[model samples]
Target: MLATRLTALLGIRHPIVQGGMSWASSNAELALAVSEAGGLGVIAAGPMYPDDLRAAIARVRAGTRQPFAVNVPLYNKRAAEFLDIVLETGVPVIIASQGGPKAHIGRFKEAGVTWIQVTANPLHARKAEDAGVDAVIAVGGEAGGHPGPDEVGTLVLVRATVNAVTVPVIGAGGIADGAGIAAMLALGASGAQLGTRFLLTPESGLHAAYKDLVLNAGIGDTAIVGRGRSPIRMVKNAFSAEYEAAANRGADDAELDALFARSSLRQAAKDGDVAQGKVEAGQSAGLIDKLEPAGELVERLAREAEAALSGAASCIR
Candidate 1:
């Protein structure tokens, strides 16, 4: 296996990280499995109450002694409370995303929790470093769920952010297999964070229908909706089509919010309501054809990345 700054910094055996996909990642089973497999498993702390967050943390701790993280999307109104939960529970790592981390970085640092901020562009990376974040996760537009308005892909965004910031940059978006991991490292990312791939893992608590949609879908199957706000990448279902059409026709913020409330990601991931619920998935969904155990997938990715790196190095000789 290959080691990088990310593995050393996060105290994980591999440089792979399972993204904290809200609703889908609320269950600690997948996180625990990934951590046990030597990769960092981050629990989704977004859209959860303080008590629920506490319970999720407890579940992870009960499952594994290895290091893990909790992703706090600042867009969540309960973000501050979630941070408090992380601090109170002594979570080893906290990933701040979806908004500025200026307010919470200091507190996280003071509590000795490793703070990794998620950025979608070079400016965000610089700002995160200024906020004193321990690391930066550069999420590109191709990523599933909310990837911000910027349309930069993972390859370009990762390289640019790595050049712009002094902190270690983790590449996200469109990454799935071992080759993708190796490619990102070559572009200067310390590691890769995968959202779609892990969502398809057997340990993930997402519904079977959602996993089937992802497995059968191609790269063109997913589309980005919600133009007025942070666009979310989701499968092209009836709900997505209606939402996109309404947004294109000048739907107000209130209308959009209503639509979101009616067809939230939680419904899609948990209830398997593909026609009405938001099926969030990255373009990497095309790369994955089957659902396997998280531990098996992690080991497979490590082996693939190691072989890919070895092959690339052979060219120099």
Candidate 2:
């Protein structure tokens, strides 16, 4: 039921993908578990330098033989260095986000690596398709971190991207279960990508406190902050509140720099400061219930999608 060009191209048994969360989602353990479980797992390259990325890639290799991907933030100053490391490591896939895919298409093609670009708008999706990338992942406003200002929902984005291009489209933002996956495929997406859902998995490197926050969150608990310049969607907390206020007041670079000088996202992830630390999570946080193994999570999602599809067919008949 999960069969699609995306899955076939990625060589994964399931069409589920784990969105790369920079500081929190790059751990090798979780990446390997997702890959071994039949989904394409992506390692976040945001917080790492070239050497660090190489080490992390090596760690993933140690855990599983299945193919996995590395995410490269195009806006990063060290993008070229990280890209070079990915090419050198023989990484099979790369997920490009935050910038134009056309900028890196040549490198990906030269390296013979599959490129999956994350886009929020249909226009960007078309651009990625024209650039000859393997696939496009359309993430809606419900996603964590930097969702675009247009902020289309998952259902809308998926359908729009599907209509706009012939390349495979992966649906993201607010997807957590088999029903969501089935719905995405029915809407013409080749696969579904989940972010907040996997944060609660046992293999995830998120702090226990952060994991607890995700488990207890409600539908409206999270809000978008830093909208105009550095828009970021995160769990509602003291830090987010302060950031939002600053952005609202049009805090200049100097003021904003002073405000964030001592604030460390990585430290917060490790220390689990729900109130003072920045927590990146999607609106789907409310839908996730318990912590389970990554493999079991993927299996359940695939089985659920199959059942949902079967049930839908029964209704049609």
Candidate 3:
């Protein structure tokens, strides 16, 4: 197994962390499977109601005593309630994002909860570390579901964030397999978090159509919409095409914002409205070809990473 700072900090066997992708990871199934496989699994709290969040947390706890996390995007209106549920349920780890960790992180810290902040840039990583987070996940624009707006890729962003902060950095974005994991560890990241790769797992909560689209998507099949506002990377489809055409014609903020708000990830995830609903996914979708069992994928990834690292070292001798 891969042992690094992330593994030691979280007491997990591998340094691989499942990305708390909304819709994909909203349920307890994916998180439970990964954790049972000796990797850190995370329940995404973004699209869940308070009751559902509480229920999911209970399910994960009931499923495994292993350390699992709940990702709560602070920008959501129910973030406060989600945090309350996380604390009330005694969830061991909290992965926070989309807002500064100064205020509420203190409360979680007081309760002896391990805090991991998701940052898009080096500056945010530094701020989160200073705010007392145990570690930080630096996700670049190549990731899905609100990657860095600055459009930095994982290579430069993770290295820069590592230099900018002393805390263990978990590199994310455009990572799909064991090779990606080895690359992150080589670049000084203690661990690697995978979003899109995990989405292809059978345990993920994605709709059948949603998974199919991502499976067939190529490297260039994804696009980034809404620059300078709230950029999202997703599969190319009718909705993205319309947005691009509007932007090309110089649409104003009001028009673009309305268009953006009209679509939702839930539409695609829940209702199978892939053409119009925001099918949020990372560019790594191109790398995914089939659905694998989450538990098996984690174990396989760890072995492959170990082999890859060994191969790299052997080449030197």
List, residue by residue over 203-257, the lDDT tens digit for candidate 3: 9998999999999999999999888789899999999999999999999999999
Model 2 alpha-carbon drift over 4 Å, by segment = 243-264
Candidate 1 lDDT, tens digit per residue, 117-172? 99988998998899899899999988999886877898899999999998889999
**Which ranges of candidate 1 are over 4 A from the true structure?**
247-261
Worst 10 residues of 2 by lDDT: 259-268
Cα deviation of 274, candidate 1, in Å: 0.6
* Candidates' C-alpha lDDT: 0.89, 0.85, 0.93
Query: Using lDDT as the measure, which candidate wins?
Result: 3
Question: Which numbered prediction scores highest in TM-score against the true structure?
Answer: 3
Shift of residue 172 alpha carbon in model 1, Å: 0.3
Q: What is the C-alpha RMSD of each candidate to the true structure, in Å?
A: 1.7, 2.1, 0.8
The local distance difference test score of model 2 is: 0.85
* Count of clashing pairs, candidate 1: 0
lDDT ranking, high to low: 3, 1, 2
lDDT of 1: 0.89
Q: Could you tell me the lDDT of residue 32 within candidate 1? A: 91
